[model samples]
Target: MEDLAQMTLDLTDRRLLSELQRKGRIFNSDLAEKVNLSASACHRRVQRLEAEGYINEYVALLDARKMGVPATIFVEITLSTQADEVLEAFEKAVQRIPDVLECHLTAGAADYILKVVAEDTEDFARIHRQYLTRLPGVAKMQSSFALRTVFKTTALPV
Candidate 1:
């Protein structure tokens, strides 16, 4: 919601996003062929998407367990105060955690939601004790361990 949408893309942009989802590192020429556009045009559109912040930096999606991050935890954080300064400090602190994959400020019983990855239960406990509960203005931290990840995605419907 931060960036205003401009330069409305037609079906070509949708196709380009779809191709990127299928192969993030796909060559520009190959992507152009798939989307029925010239290589230069495809590159330009992709650049535009990047500049607009639609496409953040690309990363190699890794297997969590193989990478020694076997545990997935979602923590709901409740802050001690609702003041702007309090919330900003809490957000800034939590965003620095490497294990935290995603975070969202929410409208519900909890103030914030966090998705974290760790090697096991002990690792999560350490993160919770040392980071989550100790974060500035944090009043409560509740964690739910994932039994299984049935669905996960980086692609958005174009």
Candidate 2:
């Protein structure tokens, strides 16, 4: 991954990124107006940013409750061994499970932490039975269910 801190962005580039972070679907003309640039110039900058990996792909955020997968579960997994092959196998297996939203290799008590979504407790139970237990090198698994979401945002500070 490119280190964002190493990239030197000018005022116009920063403005362009900030505008896009606020509204990813904004048109080139509208973005240009907001950032005080010509439409063509804004478009060129955006294309360059994408090519250079400063801007990743845009995606639509969905409502978990409306989508019938409101229950958010955080799971901590400990592996039997910290070997490279064990970690790689666990990661590859976790990626195939659809309910898993985010997974991270951690340093504290757990080898990995995962954020998962399910319809409810019953759905979570089913997922645990069908998927989590089947993950390779899983020596221990601990889970916590979120009662409510305080806030969530996809926008990154530019």
Candidate 3:
């Protein structure tokens, strides 16, 4: 398979991806119209894009507030050591935590950064007591709550 970095995206491919990112559920015919391609051609291009791993998966973006998980918390975790086994164990544990939306191994002061969501601070406290505290090799942890989200988007510029 061609590497994504090596693959060249033509203008039409970019347009198709941009449109799909904005509206994953858009009909093939509608997408064709928007990208100025015949329906059959558009279908083939979309299929090729997916096969090439340009479009990984389609998902419906949900409202966090409506889902009863409005609170957004960013946690910076510093493990006791940078040992490979400790890092692997910590990552494995985090993957099982449903509330942890994302986890990143990072450089700088913290070994890892985590994005967590919950119903509220109290719920987060429960999660902390249950999951975060039990994570392996944690030397320090700091969390910050987002008060408001002024801007948020799932679409990527293709």
Candidate 4:
């Protein structure tokens, strides 16, 4: 019963989201037309979705390679200890580094996962030394460079 309800909600949300994903800069009237909803109804639905924490934020996706951040790296970090103070300190420090765009506390072989972008190898090296390696509680670090992004989508496959 719950699954069916979820599916129904997901279907409607996906229809709305797919339209927005294709054109963030598009007007709400156009969006309503595409989604087959009255403008006011569509507006209310979008507002409700935002209020309920479904639509986090609309962002302008950048062309990273053209923007000088030609290198994309996934960094795996293992901390020395899982003490609250150590974890909080490490998290706070990582947030200060602009290159560390995304960070996730993990459950597998690694403690944290970082999505980092840098101008070049030298820039990444400097970030590694000054930011990641020196971060409190850091015991081990590994990085995976992205050769290409085959698919990156903000819209959920609802």
Model 1 per-residue lDDT tens digits across residues 30-56:
999999999999999999988877678
Task: Please give, for residues 1-158, the per-residue lDDT of candidate 2 as tens digits.
Answer: 35766467899998898888888999899999998989999999999888778898887888888999999999999999999999999999999999999999999999999999999999999999999999999999999999888988777786
Q: lDDT per prediction?
A: 0.89, 0.93, 0.95, 0.85
User: Root-mean-square deviation of each candidate, in angstroms?
Assistant: 1.7, 1.6, 1.5, 3.0
Candidate scoring better on TM-score of 1 and 2:
2
TM-score of 1: 0.91
Q: For each candidate, give its TM-score against the true structure.
A: 0.91, 0.94, 0.95, 0.88
Which model, 2 or 4, shows the larger lDDT? 2
> Which pairs of residues have clashing backbones in candidate 3?
none
- Model 2 TM-score is 0.94
Candidate number with greatest lDDT: 3
TM-score of 3: 0.95
lDDT of 3 by residue, 1-158 (tens): 55767568999999999999999999999999999999999999999999888899999889899999999999999999999999999999999999999999998999999999999999999999999999999999999999999898877777
Ranking by TM-score: 3, 2, 1, 4
Runs of candidate 1 with Cα error greater than 4 angstroms are 1-4
- The deviation in Å at residue 13 for candidate 1 is 1.1
Rank the candidate models, highest lDDT first: 3, 2, 1, 4
Error at 47, model 2, angstroms: 0.6
Q: Which candidate model has the greater lDDT, 1 or 4?
A: 1
Model 3: per-residue Cα lDDT at residue 130: 99
lDDT of 1 at 146: 99
